[model samples]
Target chain A: MRKLINQKEHFIKDMLDGLKFHDQKISIIEDSIVVRKVKKESGVAIVSGGGSGHEPAHAGYVADGMLDAAVCGEVFTSPTPDKILAAIKAVDNGDGVLLVVKNYAGDVLNFDMAKELAEAEGHNVATVIVRDDIAIDNAEQRRGVAGTVLVHKYAGYLSGHGSNLQQIVEKVENMMESLHSIGMAVHPCLVPTTGEFGFDLEEDEMEIGIGIHGEKGIYREKSETVDKIAGRLLSELLPHNDDNDIILMINGMGGTPDSELLIVTKYVMEALEEKGKTVHKLLVGNYMTALDMQGFSLTIVSHNDELLKSLNAPTESTHY
Target chain B: MRKLINQKEHFIKDMLDGLKFHDQKISIIEDSIVVRKVKKESGVAIVSGGGSGHEPAHAGYVADGMLDAAVCGEVFTSPTPDKILAAIKAVDNGDGVLLVVKNYAGDVLNFDMAKELAEAEGHNVATVIVRDDIAIDNAEQRRGVAGTVLVHKYAGYLSGHGSNLQQIVEKVENMMESLHSIGMAVHPCLVPTTGEFGFDLEEDEMEIGIGIHGEKGIYREKSETVDKIAGRLLSELLPHNDDNDIILMINGMGGTPDSELLIVTKYVMEALEEKGKTVHKLLVGNYMTALDMQGFSLTIVSHNDELLKSLNAPTESTHY
Candidate 1:
C-alpha cells in the first residue's frame, strides 16, 4: 500500500515511460513495448516478455549485446499476443527472431500464439521455454526464476556475434540443461491492482520454494540462520558430481538489502567449497526480482570453457 | 530480525568477504578494508568510507576508476582512526591521497585524526567533507546522504586520469557545492547490533526529509501519491533560477523495488519539466542505501558541459 505509483492501472505504462526517459538508448513502442533505439548489426533478434514486476529482467536488458525488444504486461499478468507480435516485428531483421519464454502457463501460451502470428507474416521465429527451477518435481512444469537471466546473457552474446538462429537456439538449450535455481521468501509482495499481499505469514516464519508471482511455496518453516538457509538452497542447486565448476548467481528478491545478500553469498560460497564445487564466475545483485519480496535466490550453472567465455562476453545493457 | 547475517559482530567482515568473492577485481586489506586488486596509474589515490550498512557506496565503488581503498566499520558505526590510517597507507603511491568523508560527526572526527597520523608518517593527505542534504536548514551541518555518490564518481574519474591531489580536491569541492539531496521513508530500517528499528511510523503515514541513517525527518504527514512526493522533493532541490541544466539521480533506499523507483522517476521528470529545468543526465538505482528501509532519495546536481562529460565518463567500478 505504500508504493510510489500514480494509479494501479497505469503502473506498467508509466514505468516504461520513465525507463525510456532515464536511458535514451531505449524507446517505447505502442506504449507497451520497449525496444533499443539504435539497431545492432543484422543478426538474430533476442526478444523476451512477461509480467511487469520483474524489472531489469526484460527491458533493462535491451541493448546492443542483450535483448532487442521487451514486451511487458500489467503487474503479474501476461502480455497479450498482439503485444508480443508487435515487439517481434519491431526488432526482427532478415536473420530471424527468438522468444525467451519462462515456464509459466500464461506466458507460454501467449508467446506461442505470437510466434504463430509472426510466422504467418513471413517472419521466421523460434521459441525456447526455460524451466530451471529445481524446487519443483516435474522439470517440464517447473517455473523459470532468476536463472533466466543467465540464459539471456548467453543467447544475447551469441546473437551479437552474428550467430544464426539455430546456433543461438542450441546454446540456449544447452544452458537450460545445466542451469538450476531455487527461491525462499520471508515476505510476500503486494499486487498493485489490489494493494494487498498475495499471502501472509508470521514474523518468524519463511516460505521455501516460493515463486516470483507470490505463488505458494512447497513448505513453510521457522526462520533459521543464514548458513542453514544457504545449505538448504545449495543442496537443491548443486549437482551430485564432485569437482565441477559453476557460475554462481545470488539474486535479491527486491526487498532484501545488499548487505544481507552479500552475507548470504558468503555462506553459499562456503557451502560450495565444502562440496568440492569451484565457482568460476559470480554475480550478486537484483537481476530478476519479485516486487518488494523480502528474500533471495541462489542460481548455479555448470560451466564449461565455452559457456564461461559466453558469460564473460561484454554487453552494453544497463543491468546485465 | 529477519536479516541474513550469521552474527551481528561479523556482519561487516562477512559481507566484505562475499564482495571479494563475487568480484575478482576487489580485495581485502588488513582483514577489514576493501581495495581494488589492480593498481591505478601514479596519481592521487581516492579513498572513502563510513559505516558498513551502505553497500555499493564505499566498497562496491572501489575499482580502477573509483576509490582505491575503502575502510569499512561495523553496521551504522564509523571506522576507527587506526583503521582509516591503515587504509591511507595501503593505497598511498607517493603522489598523495584524498579522503572523501561524509558530514557525520564521528566520520569527520576519525578521518581528521587519520589525516594527522598520515601526515606524521611523511605522507601528504587531504580531506573533503560532503554536506549536500537540502532537507535541513543548517547547510553546514546537514547529513551527507546519497549525494555523496556523485562526489565519488567525479573525484574518482579525475584521479584515475592522473590528476594531482589538488585537482581532485577542487573538483570534489565544486561538486559538493552544486549538489543537493532530499529523502523520504515509509518504514524505518533495523540496526543489526540492536535488532530494532531506529524509528516507527503508522501504515498510513510517511516521514518527509528523512535521513539515510533513520534520523527523523522535517515533518510527518499522511501518505500521498507519487506526484505530490516528487513535487515536494523538487521544490527543495531547484533554485529560484528560471532555466538551468541539471543531472538528476533517483536513488532507492535499499528496499524499494526497481519498478517502484521507475514509477517515482516518471513523476520526478514531469515535475522538473514543469519547473523549466532540463535534466541532462539521469542515474536511477540504489547507489547509496540504508539497511532495508522502504523509501528513496532524490539528488540534483546543476551541471555544465565539463561536469556533464565527467559524469558520463566510464568507470571500472561494479556499482557505478
Candidate 2:
C-alpha cells in the first residue's frame, strides 16, 4: 500500500501543481482549488468538492460544460470554509454560484458555511446537498457517492444553457430524487493520510455497499462471480418506478483493471436488458473511485429527455 | 490477486461483450473482433491489436477518426492470424486496409501473416510495425508501448481525411521514427491467466523501463522522487534533433491513482519547459495499461504541424 508521493504534508499541494497540466482550460488557485481558466461571462458558475481520494470526481468534472471550479480538500477530509470560499469567489461571474455538496457532515457543514460567507459579502449563492447513496435505510443518513457526478452534469448543463440559478437548483433537486448508487469492494483501500486500510476483508470475502471514503460496508459475503455481483448491485439499485428507460454507469475504483470493469459492464447491462429496462446511456470507466480499492459501483438515474441530453452533452472535463 | 472474472477461458469474451456499451459507434464481431458500427463509405481503414491486458489501446482507439477494428487476444498473448484476418475482412471498404502493429515478436509475426492472407484474398492490405520503446540501446529489441496510441491517432487521422493507403503508410513510417517512450513501475500486476505477479519489488524500490507484458526492466533502484524519475525518463528519450516543440503523453499503467499521474504530469511538464522545449500537445491519463500494474509511462514525439493536427482531431473512443 505504499504511495509514490513526496512528504504527506505536501501530497495535495504537489498534486494541485500536477493537476494544472490536465487541461489548458483548467488552472490552480490558492494551492487547493481547481478552477476553469476562462470564466464564461454570463452563466451561473457550478462548484463542487469533497475529500481528495475520489480522483476525477470533483476535480476531473471541472470544465466548460461541467464544473466551473472544484475545491480540493485533504485525503478523506473536507476542505475548510476559506478554501471553499476562494473557489466560489474565483469562478462566480456576475450571475451567481451554485454549491453542490456531497452529503457528509463535514462537507454539509463546511459548504453551507461557505455559502453563508459568500452571501454575506453581497454575492448571490445557493446550495444543493446530494445524498444519493442508498446503502442505508434512512435516506437522510445515506452518504453521497458516485451519483454526484450526474448531479454535476445536470446542473452544469442547465447553467451553461443560461438557466437562472433558481431554475437550475429546482431541476437539480428533482433529478437527485431519481438518482441511486451502491458499490462493493473486494479489498479495502489504503487511506494515504492514515497509512491504514479503511477495513480488512478475508481472502474470500467482499464488502458490499461501501463508501468512497472507505467507510465500512453494510455486510460481508464470500466473493461471488461477476454476474452475481452485478446482479446483486442491480437488485439493490434498480428504481421501483415504472419508467423502464435509465442511464447506467459502471464505475471502477482506482486499482481495478479495465478488463475487470469491462466484465462488470457486460453483466450489469445484460441484467438490465433482461429485466426489460432500457439503458438510455451507459458510461463505464473510472469516473469516481475510492483510492486503489478493487471494487465497482453501479449508479442508476431514471432517464428523461433532459437528463439524457445532459449526459450526451460535450464536456471539456478530461474524465467525464 | 483474485480477478473478478468467471473463468480464465471466458475472460476476453466477457470483456468484449461489455465493451459494446462504451459507444454506439463501436461493436463486436466474431466474438473477438471489435469494429465500428457504421463504416465510412470511403478512405482506408486502420486496424491494430496485440495482447489483451492493455485495455483501451487497440479497442479504445476504434472510433470514427481512429481504428476501424481491433483483434482481441488472450491475456498477454498475441491474437491469432485468423482473428487478425477476420478483422481485416470486416473493415475493408475497397480503399485498402492498414494494419498498425506493436513490435512484439508474436504480434509482428501474426499481423504480417494476416496481411499476406488478406492480400491473397484480393483485399489490398499493408502492415506498419511500431517499436517506439527507448529502454534498450538496440532499437531492434525495444518493445512497442504507450507510444503506439499516438500512431493509432496519427494513422486514423490520415485515413479519415481521405489519404490513400500508400500515403498513410508513408506518413506513419516517418512519424514512427520520431516516437520514443519509457515507463517505470512501483508494483507489478497480476496476470489473470497465470494467477501470478508479473514481477516483484521490495518495500523501497521500483523497476524502471518495464514492458507492458511485465517483462523485467533494464534495472531497479531505490524508489526515487517523482521529479527524479520523470527527469531520468526524459534524459533517455529526448531527441538530438533541434525540434524544441513536441507532443507529450503521460500514461498510467492501470493501478496508479490519477492524483499521482497528475503529480507526475506536473514534474514532466516542468522538466520539459526548463529544457526550453515547447509542448505543442499534452495528453495525460490511463491510455495504455498492464492489467493492474502500478506504474507510469512517458511518450515523447517530435512535434510537427501534421502531428499536431492529428492529435487535436476528435475521436469517439471512451478512454482516449
Candidate 3:
C-alpha cells in the first residue's frame, strides 16, 4: 500500500522504462521483453524470466556475457507465451537460444509453451529447469530462488563463448546438481496488483523456509538470533562432504539492508569455517530479491576450478 | 531490534572482517581501518570515513582507483582522531594524501586533527569538506549527505591519475559546489548501541529533509504521493537555467527496496523531462545509507564533459 508506484497496472512496464532509461545497454522489446542493446552474437543466446518483482535478476543480467534477453512479466506473475517467444526471437542468433526457467509451475508452463512456439518456427531452443531450493522435499517441486542467478552466469558465460547448445546444457545440468538455496522471511511482501501482503506473520514469528513469492515456509517459529538462523540455513545448504570448495551467496530478500547482509555474511562465513568447509568464492548482495521482503537467503554451490573461472569471467552486465 | 548483529561492541569490526574476507582487494589496518590490499601508488592517496553503518561508502570504495584507506568508527559515530591519523599514515604515499571529509561536526573536527598530526610528521596533506545538502540554508553549515559519494568518485579518479594534492583538492571543491542532495524518511533508523529509533513518526506521517544521522528534517507532514515528493525535491535541486546536464543519484536509505527506488526514479525522471532538464548519468543504489531507515535521498551534480568522463572512469572498487 505504501509502494511508490503510479498505477498498479503499469508497475512492471514503468519499471522497465526506468531501467532502460538508466542503462543504455538494455532495451525493451514489445513493452514486456528486455533485450541487450547489442546485436546477438553467433552463439547460444541466454534468456530467462518469471515475475517482475524479483529485480536485478533477469533484466539486470542482460548483457554480452550474461543473459541475452529477459522476458519480464507482471509482479509475481508469469509472462505469456507470446512475450517469451518475442524475447527468444529478438535474441536468437544462428546457433540457438536457451531458456533458463525457474521450477515454478506457471513459469515452467509458460516458458515451455514459448520454447515450443520458437522451435516450431525453426529456431533451435533448449530449456533448463532450475530447481535449487532445498526447502522442499520433492526435487521436481522445489522452487528456484537466488541460486538461479548463478545458473544465469554460467550458462551466459559458456554460451557467449560460442559453446554448442549441448555443451551449455550439460554444464548447466551439472551446475544445477550441485546448487542449493533456502530462504527465510521475517515479513511477507505485498503484491502490487492487490496492494496487500500475500500472508500475515506475527511480529515475533519468522518463516524458516519462505519462497520468493511469499510462499509458506516449512515452519513458522518465534524469531531467533541471526547466528542461529544462519546455522539453520547453512545446515540445509552445505554438502555433507568437504571434498569440494563452495561458492556461497548471502542474498538479501529485498528489504534487508546491506549492513544486515554483511552481518549475516559474517555469521555464515564463521559457520562454514567451523564446519571445515572452504568457501571458494563469496557473493553478498541482492542478486535476486522479493519485492520488499525483509529476509535473507543462503545459497551454496559446489564449484570446481572451471565453474569458478566461469563465474569470475568478465561481464559487461551492470549487476552480474 | 530485528537486526543481524552479534554484540553491539563488535558489530563494526565484525562487519569489516566479513568485508575483508569477501573482498580480497581490501584489508584491515590497525583495528577499525580499511585499506586497499595493494601498495599505495606514488600519488595523492584518497582517505575518507565517518561512521560504520554506511556500508559500501568509505570502506567498499577503497580500491586501486578510489580511496586508499577508510577510517571506520562505531555505528553512527565518527572515527576518533587517532584512527584517522592511523589511516592517513597507512595510505600516505610519497607524493601526498588527501582527506575527503563530510561536513559533520564530529567528522570535520577529527579529520582536521588528523591533518594537523600528519603535517607535523612532515607529510603533504590537503583536505576538502563536502557540504552539498540543499535541505539546510547556510552553505557553510550544510550537512554532507549522499552527494559525498560523487565527490569521492571525482576526487579518487583525479588522484589516481597522478594529480597532486592541490590539484585533487581543487577539482573536488569545484565538484562539491555543484552537488546538491535532499532526503526524506518514512521512519527513523535504530541505533544499535541504544536499540531504539532516533525519532518517532506516526503511521501516515513522513519527515522531509531528513539527515543521514537521523537529524530532524526541515518539516514533518502527512506522507504525500511519490510524484509530489519528486517535484518538491527537484524544485530545490535544479538550477535556474535549463542548459546544463546533470548526474542523478537515487540512493536508498538502507531499508528502501530497489523496486521503490525505481518507482521514485520514474517520477524524478519525468519531472526533469517536464522541466526541460537533461540527466546525463544516473547512479541508483544504496551509495550512502542510515541503518535500516525506510527512506531515500536524491542527489544531483551538474557536470560537463570532463566531470562526466571522470565520473565514468574505471575503478576497482566493488561498489561505486
Winning candidate number (lDDT):
2
For residue A136, what is the lDDT in candidate 2?
78
Worst-scoring 10-residue span by lDDT in model 2 chain B: B234-243
List model 2 lDDT by residue over A247-296, tens digit each: 88888888898999989888888888899999888988888888888888
Best by DockQ: 1
- DockQ for the candidates, in order: 0.77, 0.66, 0.58
Task: Give the Cα lDDT of each candidate.
Answer: 0.86, 0.87, 0.84
Per model, how many backbone clashes are there?
0, 0, 0
TM-score for each predicted model, relative to the true structure: 0.97, 0.97, 0.96
Residue runs of model 2 more than 4 Å from their true location after superposition: A239-242, B239-242
- Order of quality (lDDT): 2, 1, 3
- Candidate 3 achieves a global lDDT of 0.84
What is each model's TM-score for chain A? 0.97, 0.97, 0.98
Local accuracy of candidate 1 as per-residue lDDT tens digits, A225-263: 889999987776665223378888899999899889988
Model 1 clashing-pair count: 0
- True A-B contacts kept by model 2: 0.64
